[model samples]
Target: MEAMVNNICDIVLKRLYMPRVGILWTSGNHDFLRWAPSGELTWVHYLSGDFTKSSNHANNPCYIVESLTDPYREAKTLSALIIPNISLDFVSKLCLGLPFTAAGSLVFGCLDEQLPVIVDDTCITRWLRTIDPKRIDEITSRLCNLGFIVISKIGSTSSSCVLELDEKGWISWCEIADRLSGIGVVILKNGSRLTDEAEDRLRSLGIKIER
Candidate 1:
């Protein structure tokens, strides 16, 4: 099993050309994509972090972006090159603003439908548009670009925040199982869905997983 895994990794390293880093920091569950801005590809999975150094992976085509927004502080800057492990439940609390599945309603209107996509503070356009009332969903859903979830604060402080998207945008516990079932690049603990067959396929070619 280990030899096969290594061989699969070798193939993936050969197939991915330029690797861009995107960070996913959820409090729970695992298996997500990380985007690398410096590479030919827009984003790469966390597990295949070494793709740039292995085989022809550096030549395989991918997306590229100059900058990214930080989920921790809502700051936009040059993209990060590393991936951080975070918990699932903690992130969901800040993201959905809705606990699990609460009758399809949320503390704030934004998280009701969209799992990720928060009203980013760095971009005035997102903030301005969020308060418009008409485009709240549009604004909140925008967090998808940043790769995080958004939730509104109830009162007192009343600060809206963001949460990172898990492999399948599992901000709510109810969504975690389904997200894990889908194909994800990095096989983190608890990510049983990342079968050997799946890894072998990703090693050889580009794959698109539906949300």
Candidate 2:
């Protein structure tokens, strides 16, 4: 996992160039992402002590930095790299001795669905509009083969969801169902099909299904 984290940091460093970047993470869950300005990878760091301090408080506070409306926009405007859904422990490891970087509060649960998030155990995902889609597919495929179930949207505007099934199949769905709660759509891909039982289950929870 450490090796994967290092490789992901290397990818971000090679692809982005910016003065500062924001790493956003939620408490308890520890899911995190790198927020960058202009959707490009570059130099990044936390802009304030708010996020680091939030880790100690039960209720996370909000603040304004870099003249933005709020911390989220500031991070978005200044962040140059993103790695999503990683553990807080890895966040520390990723920032150790790194120049111009800081971890901050996400201020909300989950990333903006529009971003192409890499959902995995290590939170390594593709970023930047200029990044090759084929390369993203390659990484997604490799992770799937290794028994990691990936769930992401089909496109930025689409209401549908895409489920990248792991090698062990749908057995893991129950484990991840809570994460899918309140989600409104699901779209199966790569010859994957949801069993009628599963479909009914999702619908019972108010999730819509699309072929």
Candidate 3:
């Protein structure tokens, strides 16, 4: 199960592109600073609202900072650290308060900035096991019965399932469409092949194929 969780993390990381450097907002004192790389922490006295704006203009800016100290005082001195090469491990450690629960949302919320952020693997695994567990189990069982060796859910939505095919042979969507009733998207990995008939069948059934 641990191996499967890590594999899913790898798949999601590969599909999402992130920047090398990112801004991390924190209200914690310097005690929580060890998780970050040396000399990367920068204390800011004032941050213009413009700094919160991402490269893409569509993302709404969020700047909430929770602190144990005086809320008004702390807000003025919130530290916005420059994180280089951010990873799941770093986030799991540094984001001490409600780490796993809020980490995914925080990362996804900052997509427009191309933040070097990723959803913690434990968080993803927990969601998979907790949210609609029976449905997930049924889906896995059905997929395995259909000869799928690798399967994982990448998004919270029903359509976010991914199935990796063996590098060797072509697969026909007609052969598996009925079994995949709730799945709306399929990502083909490792140079997997899909016949023209499969493509047509999948599209006709409102299933998207991504290679």
Candidate 4:
């Protein structure tokens, strides 16, 4: 596991072509993609299960910002974690306007759908624009750039997508799983349907899939 982690760090550093540092901090069940403002890898520090509790994760300054209000915050990393059982009042306290580069927030909406828990639209937009097929789910329609290798047309009535991955897309499926793992997102795609081989692969890579 340690060797694999180091390899990923190297891949991100080289592929990004930036001199940014990587901070790897393990608090609960998530790993953050921390980079410097100058495009340099700094440190990879893990944090608490709750993203708002920066103090628990080495006093790192974590802030939540909305993409609609702060679009510039969506350059590189994904937004905050999905705080299950968190209330609106607690959300107000957590998002009390901090100065750190806002990663956005996830909220529970009225629809009661299995949504991506993100409150701000920025992270969703960033995810959609990404070329990684796994990252390109049909949940959000804001930035439909995820239709590169596999086009997922949004249905006005259904939240689920009927997927048919191309050979090329299937080959790069691991990349999507890795990206999601790095960002701490556990999204079950294709209505949670998958072959035993696919499930085993994702599990070995530390990517969570819905059973």
Candidate 5:
């Protein structure tokens, strides 16, 4: 009730010439900061509003498809589908010319899982330039199943990135080390220390850690 009253009061003040000022009201402080359909991702947001049904928009549709009732929604599409939960700030940066494919990977692959993830959009921009549209649809659908929301681009897209190994990446390194057992092992971690799992795997293979 207080929120409603504040919203009404804000509207009245705006009509009284608040001048170049506006605000968003959500249930929480984080939500208030996140909703930015106002000016962020101008084209993408507009297309979603213009395309999605009024009813669906009211409910904050989870998947803003090109057509809600199409039989082959998985095949072709007009605009990149978006999930409404993404921060408006993120959408704004994306619409400002980030690699759509890499952004898809970053948000769905790393960010959605709350994993410690980093990205270099510049590298992805060059590495993946001509991905098949069907591949994108496949990736998008899979990511969605994993509780991720994506904005997909049609036609060819490009993205590739490689991040430095971090403490969190050790488990993956261990898995790799396990596979290298038959091929003989040479540990080459410079200043970085091995993850416990990595050390265990190498030791199991009778390899000794100098460090």
Candidate 6:
């Protein structure tokens, strides 16, 4: 069965061969500093002529693909994918003036258990901070399953949100309260409050919520 599947895939690939696109994920910090793709590649040349001279006028620029004679020649490079939590500010710099298109996904805290999650035009973004339609649509399906409220921020369509966390496990008791006074198995819930001595002991230990 596996051999048959492999053979079928090979046949299909041979019939419709597509260039394997490579993606270098950028860490948002890289936006501050980074160079161009290093490989056996020539400078972008437009068929009409070099558009580098005309800055004020809008020109349709295209790159002339150059063949690499030495495949092993190294052009020290790095991936562009980055962490949103830390690198929110430099997104623009990393994506601006680059040759490639940008796209991204978002995950977040959800609210409804049944619906579980919601993707809107609020959170995600591309390297260039433009909306990417395909990415947004793909994120929608993933969020519904994963339960994250998300959005996008990149492309022609503009940026949009994607997914978020579900509503079930919101918060825990230990999160809000400052301290745990005692470990009594059973006690009157409201009637029994933290005693003065216990509060003092907790305070000494640097606990905020004594009782």
Top TM-score hit: 2
Q: Is candidate 2 or candidate 3 better by lDDT?
A: 3
lDDT of 2 by residue, 1-211 (tens): 9999999998677555534434333223432222223433332332243344322211112222222335445445442323335443443443342212223323211133122122332323324224554544554454334322344333423442333343334533444443441245666555566666667656644466665
Cα deviation in Å at residue 17, candidate 5?
Answer: 74
lDDT of 3: 0.40
- RMSD for each of the candidates: 17.2, 18.2, 18.1, 14.8, 17.9, 20.9
For residues 47-144, write the lDDT of model 4, one tens digit per residue: 33455544322323343233224423222232222332223333333344332423222222201222222222233334345555454343323111
lDDT tens digits, residue span 1-211, model 3: 9999999998667534322222334322222223333223232221223243322211212332221223333322322123222333434443332323233333333332322121212232445566766644554454334322212233436434544455557887545543453455777787788898767655744567887
Models sorted by lDDT, best on top: 3, 2, 5, 4, 1, 6
Alpha carbon lDDT of residue 116, candidate 1?
27
For residues 1-211, what per-residue lDDT tens digits would candidate 5 score against the true structure?
A: 9999999998666544421111111111223223444322212211222324422222122233223343132212212222333333443444443425323433333333333111212222222345443543343344434433232221222221111233332344423421231122334443556667666644643444552
Ranking 4 against 6 by lDDT, winner: 4
lDDT of 4: 0.33
Error of 6 at 145 (Å): 2.3
Tens digits of lDDT, candidate 6, 138-195: 5434433343323233332322211111223332332212212121121223334444
Q: Residue 174 in candidate 1 has what lDDT?
A: 35
TM-scores of the candidates are 0.20, 0.28, 0.26, 0.22, 0.18, 0.17
Clash number by candidate, in order: 24, 19, 0, 24, 3, 41
Shift of residue 160 alpha carbon in model 4, Å: 21
**The candidate that achieves the highest lDDT relative to the unseen native structure:** 3
Per-residue error at 143 for model 3, in Å?
12
Residue 189 of model 6, lDDT score? 34
